[model samples]
Target: MSNRIVKSSNLLNSFRYQIENSQKGVLIERKALLSSKNIELHFYETITRAKDVLMQFNLPVIAVMLQGEKTVEMDGLGKFEYAPGESLIIPAERKLKIDFPSASIENPTQCLAFIPDASLVEEAVYDYYKKTDTWDTKSDDGKIDFSADLLLRDEAILQTVNYLLYLFQEKNEHRDFFINMTTKELIIRILQSKARKAFLNNFQKNENRMTHIANYIKRNIGNPISVQDLSKEANMSKSNFFTLFKNSFGISPNEYIINEKMQKAKIIIQASSDRSIGQIARDLGYSDSSYFCKQFKNHTGYTPRQYERKHN
Candidate 1:
């Protein structure tokens, strides 16, 4: 709760002293894959000044600042900030700088970073994600820019932090299977705790409202339905329904509808090489050929004709 987040300099020294020039401390390249989703808690600590920056040509990383503060610029996630009790996320294959500025001789910054190997995130963690693609689980190339101060106090999330500390400490000497077991548990706790919180926040009441609305829209994907009519089906005033729909899913209802339609349109276009753009557009409920082409071009950045020609 101290605004005095453990400064980067102090934590770095402590991490180095603890590692004691251990051979594993010399790992220039660290990589691991968790049995679970985007949960590779790949940890690294530097005792002396780290001259070379952390660079992975094609790997996604999600870092939890275990201790200290650090400024980083990663390949795809862009400029990011970190301090104790915060998670600094970077996309895979990003080139990043770990600026452990010299604050004082006595204290150096220490850090614990998690790199979500994309394959695992896609296969495991993403598979169990609560929300739809709106959260953008499809790509592992973004940052976790929320104020982690609000999230740090979460007891469950903190417990995972403690678990990481414990695992790394034991890993220093113990080759025991229990270290791996504890490590595995730490990953799962994060998914259930932090990731699940995200899911619950969105889909908690979605079963009836969000799901029903989405399902109805999907069932009528072949029909042209206006926002007012969709609002009526939800039994809420147009404005109120629009507000709630966006709040629950974090995008306007019309945008959501368009996104879903585009997804279906992409599939249809991809599947039948013979289907003309007009046929596909009509099946998807757009009566105006030019309008459909424009919408598709905006959503996908490729006009229907261009898309078909390129893909087919």
Candidate 2:
């Protein structure tokens, strides 16, 4: 759930030039890398440590950290460390007070601020609601809430942002067209990731039927739970339940069950050093050790034993 910075010779060359010619008086040196009707990408470099530097944008901006670290403070969201392999989504017109604690002439802090057109975001939201028939009820207007900032570690978003950077840095006649297409994908990924976060954060306390089902699954995660059982709990047909659950959380009931079990298995493995893989599988209601191992590897990219070795 982390992003890796994409470094290139072109980027390094540009960064070197900027570092050498950095302004002495300003804390942050801003360079507009690419600008189009639908999107704008700007590069920022800070050559010295500073505190409480204010920044605001007219349009929603996604800030990607490439080098060094920053302590960012927003109105509602307090201070948090913004470092490499992470991103922050700032709503339009929200002011940010940022501190560059590690910036220096030798190692300047670098970041990219991507601003997609407001109309583009609205279009994406409209398309999402139309396709999924799902809305965020937590929002008073039944829309995705962007008033608060969002921190993201979604790799898909990171990759898309990197591609957009590549497009911005390169000299291509079709750059705007490609940027428009790629920005649309990035917007959808952000929306879906935000929706998933909202659902996970509120599912425990929210008294909706979906939250009730989520609670039941969490409580009985070590038991055999099927969509049929969940449908019975929801008092709906199997197909209807499946659609409703997926639409609500962007994940199927069975997939959610597997994810919950995998998360629990990770905890059990990390909490104890003496537990055997077969026993752990059984504890998670997996009668077949081989199947459990397969699922664990598929979900975590590590086998149960490997995960234990790596973590413990």
Candidate 3:
């Protein structure tokens, strides 16, 4: 997925004068709009950078871009651009190196980073799985994969962020209680966006069998997998499995497996310098490093070394 620039809200510019005049020169300067026991609203601004600024957050963040452009290199995902009207979810513990290629004194890059409560996230994820019939209750990894970093702005989420910003401005005894309620609602909207994405992935049924198999494959990617084994796992005959798999995803089961393996390999290649190509190959059940290299090149236009060079 790629970073998207959605329609910006009028409310976003309400603090522009304060944000623009307050910072300059620092790689990724920030101002705290509001900080509570469970919620944090931050204003992040950066000027045109001669160098990249590295950032890491302990908590998961929902970053809403309000002004200017930024090219970000994320851990698993390669470099991408974030601009106004766009919002992205940063998975907890992911490191990012961001560069403000288009930012300058006249037009600085401004954004809102929303750090919601961890317990609220867990609660939302739990409630989503509990209510949704699509989820496999037998699976131990019940949490949603918020790792898909790029999220195009949806009106519902943007509106929630806007409402939260407005809530921060209020000074009343029940402010905390109302903010807590809105935070939970925001969590639900985020979960809804995820659910919508999952739905779009399958395009068949709500409890999409192919989606289930895809998730299963991701979880057991390290193991030796075969079409026959996967068919049995899905409780379908070989022919039926092949047909269904092809219909759900345009690719065959074997191709899909290789694609998933290579995707994992790309992440490893970007994340670590210590792991040899052979080690990554073997970890993905490829016994022959040469064959793995060939497959990697065939799948992605670049070989492991070339991919590393481009990303590093």
Candidate models: Cα lDDT each: 0.54, 0.73, 0.69
Tens digit of per-residue lDDT, candidate 1, span 1-312:
333323333223223233233234553322222322323444444434443365553443445665544676655445555566754434344576666554222444555655433333333333344334322211132223334311333455456556544444443544334444544454445455444333222222433455667877898887787789777766557898888888888988889888888888888987897887788889989898788888899999998777877887
Residue-by-residue lDDT tens digits, candidate 3, 84-135: 7767877567789888777665666778887766555545545665688454
True-vs-predicted CA distance for residue 309, candidate 1, Å: 38
lDDT of 2 at 57: 81
Q: Write the per-residue lDDT of candidate 2 for residues 1-312, one digit (tens) a residue.
A: 225677432464543234333445554544445576788777776768887888888765778888888898877756788878677777567778989887876777888888777666556555655687664434444334433426877788888888887776667898788888888787778767754433323221213567668878998888889999888766567998899899988989989999999999999999998988888888888889999999999999998889989998
Ranking by TM-score: 2, 3, 1
Worst 10 residues of 2 by lDDT: 198-207
Provide the lDDT at 128 for model 2: 59
Leading candidate by lDDT:
2
The whole-model C-alpha lDDT of candidate 1 against the native structure comes to 0.54
Weakest lDDT window of 10 consecutive positions for candidate 1: 134-143
> C-alpha displacement of 264 in model 1, angstroms?
15
How does model 3 fare in lDDT?
0.69
Clashing residue pairs for model 3: none
